[model samples]
Structure formats: structure tokens, C-alpha cells
Target: MVRLRWYRAAPPPDLPVRQVHGFLFAPDGRAFLRVDGARHGLPGGKRELEDADPAATLRRETWEEVTLEIGAPRYLGYQLVVDGGTHRYAQVRMVALITRIHPVAPDLDNGRTYRRLLVDPRRVGDLLGWGRRGSRQAAAARQRAVVEFALPTLDLPPDGEV
Candidate 1:
């Protein structure tokens, strides 16, 4: 079984960051989700050598995967994915408010295209993978996002329609 534990603290600088994920919220407070096969999850991917930083990886991944441009990302937390009796990967989860969205291009990594969905916060739980503990942690992260990022910046709309 795989377990994902969420944390509010930044990851230790020593651990090489493998991937960066985001809980991207629309202006109306919905989340930007990506559909792949039968599973859906937040938009993000592994860091590339050209990526200047975690934020850059997220921006590039978001555009490639969903065609959305996000503003400065607010650090949410990290998820430690543990498989079997060993640790698999650690992902840094950031929250960003959507600033612009366009017709999605084909995913560079997979070559196939992806469908982007603006999921209501309440329904997001149903879309995540079961590899994580469950929807409870994702739901809690959404609630924390509302309190830490979304609600405080409610009046600011980005360049495009959310």
C-alpha cells in the first residue's frame, strides 16, 4: 500500500526534491485538475534539468498539462509517498491561483492530450488517486488553501477569466 502524509513545513534542503504539485484554484475557488486514463489529480510533474526551480517546473508543467498560467505559488506542504516498506518519493505541494488559461496543447511528456477540468472544491476528493491515504488529506489541503491563500486574495483576479 502507498501512503501520503501531508505537512505544512517546507522540505529539508538536503533531500533532493523529486516533483512539484499544486492545488491550483480558479477565481471562483474551484481547483484545476487533469484527467489521465481513469484517474485525476492536481497538475504537476517531475523536475527537469532546465527547470530553474520548483516554481519554474510547476509553471511549465501547468502550461504543458493544462494550458493554464498560474501566479506566484504559495507553499502549501509536502507529501511523502511511501510504498510497501520503503519510501518512494517526496512531492512538494504548492497552491496557486489561476491567472490565465488557454486551449490546452498536447502534453510534452506523454505526447497525448489531456482534458482540463475546473472541479468544485467539494467534489475534488472524488478525483484523486487511491494511492494516497484518501480524499481526506486532499480535502483538508483544500480547506487550508482557502484559509491561507484563496480567501485572503479573493478580490484579485488575474489577466484572464478564471
Candidate 2:
């Protein structure tokens, strides 16, 4: 059997940063994102490397925050950021396609709120350009990179179709 391995990276000092985050998109075209109370921003939105394996961290965070089981994920890209002038680190982002996604049962009190929404890739430009309340600048920066690099690289069908 072939051995499978994941890429790893180190974290910067000072800031409370996510080591890695899973960016899961459903066949129906919804993305998974979590609202972090601590940062008052979306948690899984920005990818990063954690003490643990980044892929493992993504799976765990997805289950914990959204209660979704992510299948084997593929490495999509990475994002690096400098925050508070003291903290700097890179976030490894992974992507996985799931068939179905359900809300967390019993709403396990995880101290934060998570909402899964279907987003049109075409509209991503407007969303990021205008920005939302509580959205992190770092996350936005990373997302911009994904939109520029990953999306075009995929060469998927245009909006309202796929």
C-alpha cells in the first residue's frame, strides 16, 4: 500500500491563530464556516497549520463546529498573515467535497455559533470586496488569494449553473 502523507508548517508567536482550517464545499455549492466568539470572526474561514496535522485539525474543527464528517481532503493552498504586529503564521487550507451536511444534533454547546450557507462562487467577489461585519481582515486576504489562484485554476462552469 502506498503511504499517504500531509504537509506541515510551524506557527508564529503571540496571537491565538488557527493552525489549520478545512474549507469544505458541498456538491450543491455550500461552504462551511464557523463564527469564533473569541476573535468575533469566522474560524474555519482562514486556513492555518496547528500543532497537530493540518488535515486532522480541519476534520476535527469541522466536526466540532459544524458536525460534518469530512472525507479525505485535498490540499488546496496556504495563507500567511501577520496580526497585532507581533504574531505571524501560515494557514494551510484543505478542500473536501461532501454529499450531505446536517446541522449539529442537540446543538452541542461548543461556545460558538456556526452557520452553513450556499454561496455562489461568482458572488464571492462582491462579498469579499464589500466585507461583512465581524469578518477578519486576515481571513479576507486569504480568501482573496483563494479566489484569485484556486478558483481560476479549477476552471469550473460559470455562475448560476455550478
TM-score of each: 0.80, 0.52
Clashes of each: 0, 7
> How would you encode candidate 1's per-residue C-alpha lDDT over 1-162 as one tens digit per residue?
977676777777765679998888876777777887777878899999999888898999998888889988877777777779565667888778888888768887778777777766656666776434536656766777687664533433322322
TM-score of 1: 0.80
* Model 1 ranges off by over 4 Å: 1-3, 83-88, 131-136, 148-162
Q: Candidate 2: minimum summed lDDT over ten consecutive residues — where?
A: 1-10
The lDDT per prediction is 0.75, 0.47
